[model samples]
Target: MLQCGVAIAAMLTVAPSMALASADSAMLPRNLSPWGMFTHADVVVQTVMIGLALASLATWTVWLAKTVELRQATAQARERMAALEGGASLAELARDCGEASDAVARLVQAAAHEASLPGASWDSDFKERIALRLERVEAAMARRVGQGTGILATVGAVAPFVGLFGTVWGIMNAFIGISQAHTTNLAVVAPGIAEALLATALGLVAAIPAVVIYNHLARVITGYRALLGDASAQLLLLLSRSKGRPAVAFGRAG
Candidate 1:
């Protein structure tokens, strides 16, 4: 009888430990990974996360394409300006530079075309017209070069809010779980809170780089526009020198 009583006591002790161990195993996550969190996240949160990721990709793509285009354009403008540094006639420069979309080349061609027209004059009025045309070209080139940058601004402005929405949704879902489970245990709450904060972290990850990239590209584009203005000034100086001279043939073969 005494041995049977001792066995009952041991069984009671072992039973509680086994029950606690089972509870702990159930509380712990099977895989505490980002991909796992994503898979287990609410549908709305998942959608927001996906959208923010795509926006990040768009920011990088625009940065790459615009960087290449702006660098090439800035270099070409400098080269054209250097070619004009010598006493080369505007007609000679235009022919050698060809009829590409080069800012300096186009400016020269426009001036030459105006000069070739019947009744064309090189007076204060004529010079004003040329200056106006140059300004229009500058504006157009600026617009063209700045295309696709607006998306960066949009991403920078919206990504954080999108992430915040996801976080709010996640926390709300966590509270719902708490209410359903009828418990305030740390194990029950920590997972949901961590997941909610993860949304905010992802948001910062997406937004900070987008804002930085947009500002950097803005500065680079501004510099490129300044180069275009310098090219316009150089062309105007060439025209000023040739104002009273005989008409020069442009695009003539050497």
Candidate 2:
């Protein structure tokens, strides 16, 4: 009778193991399983992710290209300006600039034009007009240097939440599956959770570089703006001195 009891107890333990194994097998996701949660994700979510990725790439590309162009342009402009400071005429400077449309050259041309104008005054109103022209030029330069950066800001601001949304949707789907299956089997939940996490990871990947690049480009642009402002001031000073006027008095009059 004791031996019979031992056999029955062993069978009881083995039976539960077998049942659990059957449940796991049934819940296991197939290798060919569909995209599951991702499949159910709204098209907007997918589009946001894709657009973020593309924007990030575009910003990086523009940053690299503009960095090279600006550096080269600044170097050339500085070289030409140094030569001009040593007494080269405006006509000479323009000729040397040739096909190069550097910012400094443009400023010089504008100044020369104003100086040559029949009724151009060096007084306060004239200076104000010159300042307006310079400001417009500065704005144009800023726009060129800052191209494609706004998208990065948008991505940085929105990607994390987009990822979270995707994750939440995926988790909700996983819970629904668990409820339908009436089992707490890991196989039923793990795949959905993994998919959800992947979206979040992708979102972060899209955001980090965009944020970094945007900051870097912003610094470069700020430096450029300061440099242009200084150059514009120097040009005005040159005009004042050439007209046999004191710098402070001329500036105040303008």
Candidate 3:
């Protein structure tokens, strides 16, 4: 009988404590979704997240713009290269090319201008001059096409470290909160830890695509450069073959 009474007293003592804990649990915030954690994160962490998101946005934007530009440029260049194979003289080729502002068109115009110079005898030196003009145009066009790609390289190289900084800052804040709260409860610390990791995740998300895109763009640019080289070679061949022909051949397309 005494033992039963002692057990009842112990149960009575614990009942109210359990009820109070249940009340506190009900009052605590429960949703731990990513957005929820982000919304509740420290200001510095939030800034880091926002910056990373912007970087990712920039990466995709560049990818889209460069993709469109490369596709059009490659198509035009291929068409012009095919035109070079037709037995069209420089004058005829220029006329057929119309007033297109493409690099190859400028190349044809430069060769014609050099040929038309009164001093331009259809000699080795004349060919050299024509080659030089085409080279300059090629270089200029390549630079123009590659103008905005540097940012992708910059983002790829720096984004991870930026995220790391945010993660460190967030973890630091979490530790401070742990000190203030004087508890090792997972509930108290887990959200901050998760927020810190989210920053790192965002950084990787921004960086990886930037790197892949930069590399892909670089390869496409190289192929485009090769097309320019082939065009230059074909033009030089045409100039050389017409060397013995009448001055009229050089008249339009030296």
Candidate 4:
């Protein structure tokens, strides 16, 4: 009986020691793992990532919408100019192109209005005046075409550095935590580094699309500018040829 009692006492002592060791291991905080570090990262890093994602989506959406609009504008302007060059009257051209929102139509309308000005007879200088008016119309068209594209330029130029700032901030915090804990384990430093990298990746995700779309939209806007300039030149040539001639009245006998 004494031997059995001694055995029970010894087992009880061994079990408590094992439990204490397990509790200490658990209390060591899992070697300060990356997952634990990430849980403590600044909220601002997450906010920046969210913002970059939103910016990328917005830029791509705008790029798609603008491309379709510019393509349609170009095709319609081409068709309208071809009809005008085929000797269609201004009124007929306007009616045929009523559905078009191209810069060419605005120039044509401006010229028609100038021609209808009272006491402004068609003279040698009429073409010059009409050309000047067309220039103004072209400028307006350019402004319209370029609207909202500046946002892409701003975002592309700024997003990378913004991400870099987040990376730097995160790395600084990681180092500070390492210094405090006096540990170099992968678990201790990985989370902060991963959080930092996430910012840079998000920034690039936002910036690359912005840059690509900006370039594409710029080319489309350039093409529209060229089309408008060509249409204006053609209108001026027609005006020069019709100088000193009475304006042809449409839909009414003069």
Give the poorly placed runs of model 1, Cα more than 4 Å off: 1-28, 249-254
Candidate 2: tens digits of C-alpha lDDT, residues 46-154: 5545655675676677678867876876675577557557665544554555555677766766655555566555576666666677777767766776677677688
For each candidate in turn, the TM-score is 0.87, 0.74, 0.87, 0.79
lDDT tens readout by residue for model 1, 1-254: 99999999999999986775566457545655877777777898888788888888888898899899988988988888897777677777767766678676777677666666666667667778778878888888899899999998998988899889989999998888778666676776777766776787788788898899999999999998898888888888888887877665444221
CA lDDT of 245 in candidate 4? 78
TM-score of 3: 0.87
Worst 10 residues of 2 by lDDT: 245-254
Clashing pairs in 3: none
lDDT of 4 by residue, 158-229 (tens): 999888887888788778866865566565567667777778877888898899889989988898899888
Top candidate by lDDT: 3
Judge candidate 2 against the unseen true structure and give its global Cα lDDT, from 0 to 1: 0.66
lDDT of 3 at 229: 89
Give candidate 3 misplaced runs (Cα > 4 Å). 1-30, 246-254
Residue range with the least summed lDDT across 10 consecutive positions in model 1: 245-254
What's the lDDT of the predicted structure labeled candidate 3?
A: 0.85
Please give the lDDT score at residue 217 for candidate 2.
Answer: 72
The stretch of ten residues in a row with the least summed lDDT in candidate 4 is 23-32
lDDT of each: 0.79, 0.66, 0.85, 0.76
